[model samples]
Target: MAATVTPENPRTSPTISRSVTHTVNGSHKFVIQGYSLAKGMGVGKHIASDLFAVGGYHWAIYFYPDGKNPEDNSTYVSVFIALANDGSDVRALFELTLVDQSGHGKHKVHSHFDRSLESGPYTLKYKGSMWGYKRFFRRSLLESSDFLKNDCLKINCTVGVVVSAIENLQLHSINVTESDIGSHFGALLDNMEGSDVTFNVAGEKFPAHKLVLAARSPEFRSKFFDGLDVEQQEIIVTDLDTKVFKALLHFIYRDTLTEEVDEVSSTTSSDFLISETLTAKLLAAADKYGLERLRMMCESRLCKDICVNSVSIILTLADSCHATELKSVCLKFAAENLAAVMMSEGFESMKENCPRLQSEILMTIAGCEVDSCSAGEKSQSVWAQLSDGGDDAE
Candidate 1:
């Protein structure tokens, strides 16, 4: 039965919004062994590990094998995390781990989270403040543990940094127009009316701008503008075919491959989508011209299309071009599919032409077999089989 009340003004109670903040974590792993470990065994002898940049600050792991103090020597091992870069008081959470590699699954980990106290993460002030356990572990116990393998130990450190950032909220509607700079460049490439130089590739002419070519490639720059007599209006490229040259020029101008690559061949299976032959040729040309990004693109494409029929040829190309990542991928694939790959015609060609590649492949296969084989009798049996195969190949 009561009297009604009026609502407050909407303008007086306006909604307010602020930005969000988040944390980022970075981790680094360092392995110390051999003579380095012996040198770090003295009291007060601390070695600064290799510097790793994480969370905008340079950080390092400090190891004191015999402890940092005279009293703790022979009883405990000391380890610390140090900030190598200059900064104000920075707050971070850190974890130091000694990996266990002896069949057992026991790994020793120490971190700021281990403490049950209500206090927050450790705050490092200035550049040199250290945050770690002075008595990390007992020396005798660690020496006998799986953490120490072959007189070497692996230490992994992860740092979690808390940062404050603001992201503004849009309170008003806005309209934006997207720019099409790439399409404009594509148009410029297609309309090559004022081209200054021409490349004759396999009886076909490809007109290009001298400044544009020079801007994209150092090799082109050297060939055109580096010397007075070296400058030429027409250059002959006899090594590459017309199609490969066209694709290369397209990448130089448009930063992309031609659309024909998307079209599938009617003869081959759907799995064989891209032309491996064309990609291999392009990779060689890109390597020859020092186009690193283009070469990487070609390598990545070849890596994805690897199969039993293509592994041998891809391995040969990868080795010739010194494409490390692609070579590793090809080797692993060949090793896993060893019996089937060796039966292919491409494998025979690789064996006859590239003897060094054959040796590398055999060694890689041996390594793979050893990793999967258990220790003792089974490991020796696997090694014997690998040896027999190598002798037969020779």
Candidate 2:
């Protein structure tokens, strides 16, 4: 028989071991641990990083250095732990820690649980960083290494932790750190950097079209281009002075386009406005290239500085772009202020303006007169009916 028990030392790591016990009648019994895993701590590294495997449970144990609740730090930071299976229908365990730049572990808030671990065939859901654990524990654990990546999820593990989770748990596969994400980002940056990238983009050779397009734009030429064809060289020089073209070329080559506002145009306007335009253009380019942050910035500017003149433009633009929330707000505002809008000096010029509202005072007078007229009509109808009945009696 085998039995597991906990010790008084809360800090000392707990282990559950089993050994076969033989009885006098050739019967056998197993002893089990009575201790419960601390709340939020789960048994088994039931998740795989890559390759779906059968009969695996995805499991994650989050760690926090300062003991902050996972919900509080959901925005800027997260701690996630994926558990791999270690066979034998037993709980899996791993050492966890939080470290600073100096590589010293933060021990004060570190916590662990002593609980029975087991893995079985199950499905797990992977969601946001923190919510991953809450939704599909097993799936979240397996997929998290890929899902968390550079945005927020933070943690690292030795290869053993990964291998065990994959091999023993029968999990689909193991995820790499930033697990699957950093490499893609690095690849994109690699494409941006050209030969300057130490790593390749998406594990493939850089495409030339992006470089050429970046070279052609006024804002990006300084940052993205280096060597140009004779035709491009001549065209750039003709449209832009050699000095400006040279600056553009420098930006293209370095991929570092930094410029100040130039003291409100005291300096070259090209250096100021051109660079800002380039920044906006590059953001657009990034969005086109599927850069998440660039797209976010483009979208974030919509609700800012909303005004009468701009609101109409924004409304139309948002509608064309299918921005439902923005369109709803604009429509509501238009409905509420439509009356005042029609009274403005330029209201007559707008095709949508209502001219009938100008006669509101006359309409009130007509309404009163109509009530008097309607009263006379009702009396005539009644007299006609009464006269018909009297004639019949006669």
For all predicted structures, in order, the TM-scores are 0.50, 0.23
- Candidate 2 lDDT over 296-340, as tens digits, reads 343344444233333344344444444555545544544444444
Give residue 128's lDDT in candidate 1 (0 to 100).
86
**Distance (Å) between predicted and true CA of 324, model 1?**
2.6
lDDT by residue for model 1 (258-331), tens: 76544323225432223346777888888887788888888887786677777787788888876778988888
Give the Å shift of residue 100 in candidate 1.
Answer: 45
Steric clashes per prediction? 0, 30
Model 2, stretches more than 4 Å misplaced? 1-296, 340-394
Of candidate 2, the 10-residue stretch with the lowest lDDT total is 23-32
Query: Candidate 1 — which residues are off by over 4 angstroms?
Result: 1-168, 172-179, 227-230, 262-276, 366-384, 387-394
